[model samples]
Target: MGKKLFIPGPIDVRKEVLEKMSTPMIGHRGGDASTLQKSISEKLQKLFYTDSTILLSTSSGTGLMEGSIRCSTLKKAAIFSSGAFGDRWYKMAIANNVPADLFKVEDGKAIDIEMVEKVLSTGEYDVITITHNETSTGVRNPIEEIGDIIKKYDDIIYCVDAVSSAGGIKIEVDKIGIDICVTSVQKALGLPPGMSICTFSQRAIERAKQISHRGIYFDLLAMYEYILKKDYQYPSTPSLSHMFALDFQLDEILKEGLDNRFKRHEDMANLVRDWSRKHFEIFTDENHLSNTLTVIKNTKGINVSNLNKKLQERGYQIANGYGDLKEKTFRISHMGDYTLDDINELLDNIEDILGLLNKVY
Candidate 1:
């Protein structure tokens, strides 16, 4: 019943995007569906800044995360973690019987590039998973710089989880040499959950061809082969509604101007960071804070759950800390279609609920 969503995902969908989702569904394999899929793919290629093929998944971003690790990993994978989502990728790897070793940094910090270099130097891994933005810790890894290092090994595939940063921030997929870049509709894309998008390089497709155990539902090789025959449509019934919304949403995003959108997110993130510094400590590394979300350390010892309950009563929502960090911190997301005015209102509400009118910035 809230007018806004300040949580990490399923952010406030614009009225236009919501309306597009309501358009009448067409047969998934028909001309209409192919047109919709082809259009979205082309637009997404622009968003990703790559000429590589874009793949659509009816499931969430995690589905493609799993698929990327499953399909592209030939010998082994080096899973890098900055927070919970990165850890989830490793979990998916083990669950699918994909051999992988996890590398994680301390909480609130990103994995060092030197560490990544050291690990990759061992030549034990053919695939690597990196999170562009860790929503849990509010840390944005330096993927471009890291990608430069990873690219030298042509045989190695680098898969990036950009679920929370793709549209809100600029990710030059080709420049970064990302073999597989995965994202979803709910976060920075400013659409509802249910649809996911990924850009896959030809190198990744070739690797998938060598792997016999890549699951059917998420087989990148199958997706590649089927789309070659059809007009960029999926093997199964695609979510036409999500595609409709995405087609429209991508237009709005491009019109808004990618640089301007990135600037807006950066501006809002700076505002929140300044506010957090004056009030409480930021959970993530200051140098690598995420543009889409801010995690504030609960230094003031306020009851975050109670505060959120009060916030809900006021028709607003914010996320409490995640995993082991719960109650120690709270997150406020700046992604989606939200503006600075929206964030100011949310902060005002939080200040009022905490009785920190004087304490809060």
Candidate 2:
């Protein structure tokens, strides 16, 4: 059997979902494909709690991230970053020559709301980007609170990268006034990596219309218009395999119930968080801890690589900390279809390998 995954993403897809990926392919422009796309869009709208147009790209979540900022940022952008992925938005802006500035906080901390307010009050930015969940630091930003601040600026387009939290956490997209929210199926959506999806607001489309030179392949306005013009068909040939699996998995998600799914993720997160506090220390801010994954401080100074090797022997695997945090911390993902029982089993294995079975909390 494959090692049960506890890493952040491409998190163990359900066998049924994997099977759907292999179903016979459909013609890209056929009516069957349009039906599939339409069904997926409707289900995603429910998942996202928004009536905004849903766009699909046969690329990773970063593809839409790049598109959203590039297409909508007419003036300068205020990129508020709390971790690595947040930093990436700023990089995408510069690479696309979108003219932007980056506002960052210390690692393991959520973006400061007051800092965002101070920057937006400057009236220098027409667009703003926030990362709802930062896996590198295990900090889930208070997007709802930040959204309230953004609501005060009517002209500023609000975009969020909910890559790791969209399916697992409760984000009321419309209620929060987010114009563009991006996520991939590989993470909480419980499918293999290939395609990404997002909700594009009318406000964003209007903003995109004001900008020129929005790149062709990843252009949000073009994609949205193409779908409306061609009956939910995309501008380019799409990934039918991923689309097949996503349609089936989204139904499964709805069958399980959104509230139940969110609660399961929270329960699994709490299980791992409590375990981390007892065995080591939680790396990110306690108040802003991620509901999808927990990053643990390596206070014990154990060899993470060796620990993972031992876990592989026992048929389980978890992630080490990302980037510079590697070895200084470790991560335990409870997103996707993993249950509390699964979290317990992985923790039990870690305790056995570390000889902490009899140790008192």
Candidate 2 residue 111 Cα shift, in angstroms, is 0.4
Each candidate structure's TM-score, on Cα atoms with residue i matched to residue i, is 0.98, 0.99
Residue pairs clashing in model 1 are none
Give one digit per residue, the lDDT tens place, for model 1 in 205-264.
888888987888898789978888998888988888899999999999999998999999
Q: Candidate 1's error at 93, in angstroms?
A: 0.9
The per-residue C-alpha lDDT of model 1 at residue 102 equals 97
CA displacement after TM-score superposition, residue 340 of candidate 1 (Å): 0.9
Q: What lDDT score goes with residue 224 in model 1?
A: 79
Which residue runs does candidate 1 get wrong by more than 4 Å?
Answer: 359-361
Q: How many pairs in model 2 have backbone atoms within 3 A of each other, for residues 3 or more apart or on separate chains, i.e. clashes?
A: 0
lDDT of 2 at 103: 95
Per-residue C-alpha lDDT of model 2 across residues 1-361, encoded as one tens digit per residue: 7779889887888889999989997899999999999999999999999999999999999999999999988789999999999999999999999999999999999999999999999999999999999999999999999999999989999999999999999989999999999999999999999999999999999999999999899999999999999999999999999999999999999999999999999999999998998889999999999999899999989999999999999988899989999999999989999888888999999999998877652
